[model samples]
Target: MLQPPGALPIRVLVVEDNRDICDNIAAYLEKHNFILDFAYDGISAMHLAVTHAFDVIVLDLTLPGMDGLHFCQKLRTEAKLQTPLLMLTARDTLDDKIKGFEVGADDYLVKPFALQELHVRLHALFKRSNGKAENVLTVGDLTLNKSTLQVHRSGQRIDITPTCMKLLQRLMEVSPSVVTRDTLETLLWADEQPDGDALRSHMYKLRQAIDRSFEQPLIHTVHRIGYRIAEDM
Candidate 1:
């Protein structure tokens, strides 16, 4: 199978109850330069899938506690995650596969499949998910190129610090949606957090860089809630 197009590793979440299957897939995919995260059951998988971003999700249909169908439904509807999901199941019936797609599975793979086939399918799914957009993130005229780390607004190039860029990327990724202060803090510092409004200080620097010169002011504070990148829709 071909490696995903990029210098960064392809992040994959494999949600399978079968230990043997998980090990087998991990051994092969890891050799082929793919980063994999595993969850034995659906409940923990749901938490991982919602909280973390992955290039593709390889999910088995029969899972304990939550089951793949319900997990997929909640991931799509409740979490609003558009990550590509591929279902692995022994059920070969058309109805079973249809149910998988109806619940927002991007592709289906039957059990006892070859490891090579799974790799190929996953690469394809990742390509399809990232098609056309080509690693460029945009909120209004502000564009941040993932590959280049370049930011531009209103046809003018804007210089952004790496720290500010991280904050900008998160806000733009979920544009128009309030991203809580807690969430941003977790993303920025993880467990070894800085004390006393360090996040607010960085946010202030970011705002001055991205919004001070622009008239339309895209970044908005939600007033005790968090921040968002939007143009007042």
Candidate 2:
């Protein structure tokens, strides 16, 4: 699935041993609006995968200490994680693919593959596992439904444009944590931010829609940092 511009970026964990390949994947995926965390070894990959929630994991079959097969086995049996795992390696034999699947890989892709194909396969795995991307996100009394593309505050429906809806979704996804201006701009505009106070203007409109009628305010400015969505004391 081709993600529309301004859509929430999918968080990905990339476990590859080759530094050059890793850098190339990072550059390509980030440009396509996928947030990434890297790990060069199976041990480190397992640590990062268990600690953070990732939309998908791209793992290499060969590693320094632990290999990808063992990593997948441990992830499924020990961690009990159901996150989509895409095995990337040079092993393309029927036995290799079967082994990967037995160890809990959702998809397998050989080396020397096109980045576009990787992107498409990742989305396919995500969709198959998640069964549609719409999720109802909530922060305190505020609610945003991803499937319905609707926003509500304190049980009252609020009208917001698509731009405002994206901004609100980002803030609510990381509720109670400040979302810096740079990060917000990257998510919203994908490196093509407009001049002047466009973000501020949209933020003003969002605040009005979300807080204008409520007694307690939820959106807050963190001085020179960024903005967060949380109930005020």
Candidate 3:
């Protein structure tokens, strides 16, 4: 898969009870620069999925404690997580695949699959999910394409890390309105924020990317309140 320069590694959760299978998947995925978290059962998976942000989920259909179908249902209907889910199962029947889809699985793969195939499918799912939002956000001379994850200012392309992209997206989405520090922190880290000035550090980098070289600054600090992006610096 093609990643933007300095882009963050894809975050993935693998929910499978089989230790051997999880190990194999982890080894292969890590080799490809993916950051993976493991959950041996659906219960723990649900907790992780609810509390943290993930780019995708690789769910095993026969997971212990809650099973994949129920876990998918809970995430979609109750927890409201829209993270792409790829179901892994030993059953290859048409009914089984239909059930998986009905329960909110974005893709499915039968057991004894090749690791290469798994990687391909995961890349496809990530691409599909990102392409869902076709809207391009603009604030002043800065423009961000949500579908392509491209950012340009004054008609020049700007390289940005994924975190910076997210921060810019949020600020541009609510241009001229202050986005609270708490809200930006939640957007960046979910429930796992790091200590002391981390948000400031990121905001500084974002400002540098979008404002440092430009003639007029589009991002403004709201003085202990938050930050806002507008035409007037």
For model 3, the local distance difference test gives 0.86
Per-candidate TM-scores read 0.77, 0.57, 0.59
TM-score of 1: 0.77
lDDT (Cα) of model 2: 0.85
Q: Over 4 Å off in model 3, which ranges?
A: 1-5, 133-233
Q: What lDDT tens digits, residue by residue, belong to model 3 across residues 140-228?
A: 77899977899999899999989998888878866777777866787788778898989999999998999999788888899988899
| lDDT for 132 (candidate 3) | 80
Residue pairs whose backbone atoms clash in candidate 2: none
List clash counts for every candidate, in order.
Answer: 0, 0, 0
Worst 10 residues of 2 by lDDT: 183-192
> Which of the two, 1 or 2, has more TM-score?
1
| RMSD values, in order shown | 3.4, 10.1, 7.8
Candidate 3, run of 10 with poorest lDDT: 1-10
- Candidate 1 lDDT, 204-228, residue by residue in tens: 9998988899888888888998888
